[model samples]
Target: MVKTSMSHEDYLEAIVMLGGTTEVPVRSVDVANKLGVSKASVNKAISALKEQALVIQPHYGDITLTDEGYAYGSSVLGRHRMLFDFLTKAVGIPPEVAEEEACQMEHAISDASFEKWEAFVKGLDV
Candidate 1:
């Protein structure tokens, strides 16, 4: 698998979020709106993802993730959710603040550290 930058990861996560539960087509505009980015930016990011074989979009068609893309996006989403929960519940941070911070921290956090943090947070409930 190709190593992705934080920006690429963000785009992948946005695509999954926009698609939600349904397998409906997710357009570039939808991804742009979700990420608050421009269409051009989305196009560029999507191109990179395509090169990595993580996403596929036909000419003027809707965007869709490949199997690898889905797995990667899900992992990123999981990290974001876990960080958000930890920041808000364990650290007593406000939801808005935690949300923003978690988004930034999710890209930088390592899997080992994240697992430890998640375990510690869950342990508090037991």
Candidate 2:
């Protein structure tokens, strides 16, 4: 897998969340709104994503994820969901705090460890 900065990963994830995987292309403005960033920030990140061949966009156009981009973004989003669930359901963390913490943890956790933890969580009766 290509190594990308966490910021790039966030952009990819945001794109996916905004339905970039669908036939309807996602607007850059939507991505900016989702991430609470400026349009220029989205533009800069989109440039980097284009260089990595993760997204396709024309001048002032909508964004669509390539297959690789979708897969990568889905993985990151999946990690965030899993961490959020564990934090809120098992650890009894507040939803607001868990959301923020899970976002940070999703980037730092190793794939192997996360897989094991996911399996463990699944094995639980709860």
Candidate 3:
């Protein structure tokens, strides 16, 4: 997998969340709205993603994820979901706090470490 910045990962995840995996492409404006950023920011991120061949977009057109992009984005989203669940359900953190923390942790945790942690969590009775 291509190494990408955390910001780029966020953009890819946003695209997937916005249905970039489907035949229907995702609009830059929607991505901006989802990420609480400007259209210019989305444009910049899209440009970077295109450079990486992770997404396809025409001039001023909607965005669609390539297969690689979808897989990477889905992995990030999955990590976020798992971390959020652990924080909220297992640790009893507030939903809002867990959401924020999970977002940060998802980018920092190594895949190997995450896998081990997941195994540990699964082994728990509760």
TM-scores for every predicted model: 0.90, 0.94, 0.95
How do the candidates rank by TM-score, highest first? 3, 2, 1
lDDT of 1: 0.85
Q: What TM-score would candidate 2 get against the native?
A: 0.94
* Candidate 3 ranges with C-alpha deviation above 4 Å: none
RMSD of 3: 1.3
Alpha-carbon RMSD of each model? 2.0, 1.2, 1.3
Q: Residue 29 error for model 3, in Å?
A: 0.6
Tens-digit per-residue lDDT, 73-103, candidate 2: 9899988888889889998999999999999
Superposition error at 84 for model 2 (Å): 0.3
Score residue 52 of candidate 3 by CA lDDT: 99
Query: lDDT of all the models against the reference?
Result: 0.85, 0.89, 0.91
As a whole number from 0 to 100, the lDDT of residue 104 in candidate 3 is 97
The residue-by-residue lDDT of candidate 1 on 9-39, one tens digit each, is: 9998988888732255589999989999999
Which is superior by lDDT, 1 or 3? 3
